[model samples]
Target: MKDSIGEKQVKVVIMKKFLIFIFTVFGLFVGWIAFMVYSYERSYNEWKSSYTGKIVTNSEKQFSSSSSSTQNYDYKKYSSSSDGNKDDLESLMNMFMKRLFPPTLLDPDYTYAYEKAKSWSKKHLSQQQIIIYLTKYDRYSEDATQYALNKLNVDWKEQALLRAKSYQEFHYSKNKLVEQLINIDKFTQEEADYAIEHVHFDWKENAVKEAESSSNGGNISKERLLKILVEYRKFTQEEAEYAIEHAKIDWLN
Candidate 1:
C-alpha cells in the first residue's frame, strides 16, 4: 500500500511540472509576439514622421514665400526617368506621392481611370472615344472618368487625323471616313472635318479597291459589286461606277 501511494504522488508531481513548463513556454511566446508587434509599429511611425516632415519642408521651399504665387517649378525634380509629357509626368508624381503618403487624397478610382485614359491616349484615341470606352466598356464611374479626362492635355484634332490615317489601308471615302470618325471613333464633327481635310486619300481609287476585293470570289455580278460599294461601303454612285469600270471581274460568269 505504501509503495502504491508513493507511485501516485510521483505521477502527480510529474504532471504539475509538465503543466508549469507548458504555461511558461506559452507566456514567453506571447511576450515575443507582443515585442515584434511593438517594434514594427515603432519603426513604421518613425519612418512616416521623418518622411512626411521632409516632404512638407521641400514643398514649402518649392512654393516661394515672398510673392506667395505658385510658379511653374521644373517638374524634373519630381519626375521619374521615364519619357512622358509634362502633364503625364505631373499626374504620375501625384499618384506616386499619394500612394507613398496618405493625406488629403485622390480616390483610387480616379488614379486608375487617369492611367487607363493615358494609355488609350497613347494609342491615338480621342478624349471622347476614351470617355465612351471608359464609361461603356470598362464600367468606370462617369465622375471619375470625366475627372481623368479633364486632366489630360490631348489634341483631339491630331488624334482624329491619326485615326483617319490609320484607315487609309481600308480605302474609305471622304464622307464615309467622316462618318466613321464621328460615329465610330467618337470624334467631334469639327475634328472629323479637320481629319478629312488633312488626311490624303483618293476616294475613287478606294472604291475601286473595295470593288475588286468584293469580286475576288468571281461569283459576284458587276451590279452587285456596284450596289455593295455604293450602299454598303458608303461610296458615292459616281465612285462606284468608276470602280465597276476599272476593277477586273467576269460579270457573265
Candidate 2:
C-alpha cells in the first residue's frame, strides 16, 4: 500500500511538470506572434509613409518631377529581393505579411479607382481630365488614380484631334479652336497644333456656314452677319467677306 501511494505522488508531480512545460511553450509562442505583428505593422507604416503623397502635374515635362512615382511601388522588387530561405523567420514573416495585407489595401477604394480610370480612358478622356475627375469629383486616392493613369496607353495628340473634331459642329475659327483646345481641354500647344494640322477642316467653308447660321435663315442682313462672323466668331476679314458673298442671303430683305 505504501509503494502504491509513492507511485501515485510521482505520477502527479510528472503531470504537473508536463503541464508547466506546455504552458511555458504556449506563452513563448504567443509572445513571438505578438512581436512579429508589431514588427510588421511598424514596417508597413514606415513603407507607406515613404510611398504616398506624390503630385501629378499637367505638363508632360514635369511628369518626372511631380508624378506617379508613388503609385509605381515595385512590390515584385521587394518580394524578389526579400526571398530568402523558407526557414528564415524574418523572410517568411515578411512574405506572409505582404500576402496577408497587400499595399493596395491601404486605399480601400483602389479597385474602384483604377477601374473607373480605365472606363474614363475608354471614353477618350484626356489624362488631365481623368486625373482631375478621379481625384476631385470621385474622391479616389491619388496613388491609385495615378497608377491607373500610368497604365493607360494614350496618344495625347490623337486625343487632341478627337476633341478638336468635336468642335466642328460649332462655328469655331482656327484661333478659337486652338484657344479652346489649350485652355479648356488642357491640351498642350504642340498637341493642339498637331490636332489642328491633322483634323479635316475648311475654315472658309466653316465661315460660310457660320454666316448663314448668323443670318438665322435670312433673318439678319449680310452686313450684320459679316460683323457677327468677323467680330464674334473670330473669323478673318477675308473669310467673312467670302462667307458674305457665298452664303444664301438676301441683302434686300
lDDT for each candidate structure: 0.79, 0.77
Candidate 2, residue 224: CA error in Å? 2.3
Best lDDT among the predictions, by candidate number: 1
lDDT of 2 by residue, 1-253 (tens): 9999999999999999999999999999999888778777776565445333221222334444544664443553356445533324454455446445654664457677878988887666677888899999998877778767766768888988988898899968888899898888788889999999998799999998888777766767777888888888889999999999899876647
Which ten-residue region of model 2 has the weakest summed lDDT? 51-60
Badly placed stretches (over 4 Å) of model 2 are 1-108
Clashing residue pairs in candidate 1 (N, C-alpha, C atoms within 3 angstroms)? none
Candidate 2: C-alpha RMSD after superposition:
18.0
Please give each candidate's TM-score.
0.54, 0.58
Model 1 C-alpha lDDT per residue in residues 1-253, reported as the tens digit of each score:
9999999999999999999999999999999778666655665565557657867996797664444333424455546325434544465455445445432255678778888999998888888889888999988898789878877778899999999999999888788899899888889999999999888788898988888788874678887788889888889999999998987776746
lDDT of 2: 0.77
TM-score of 2: 0.58
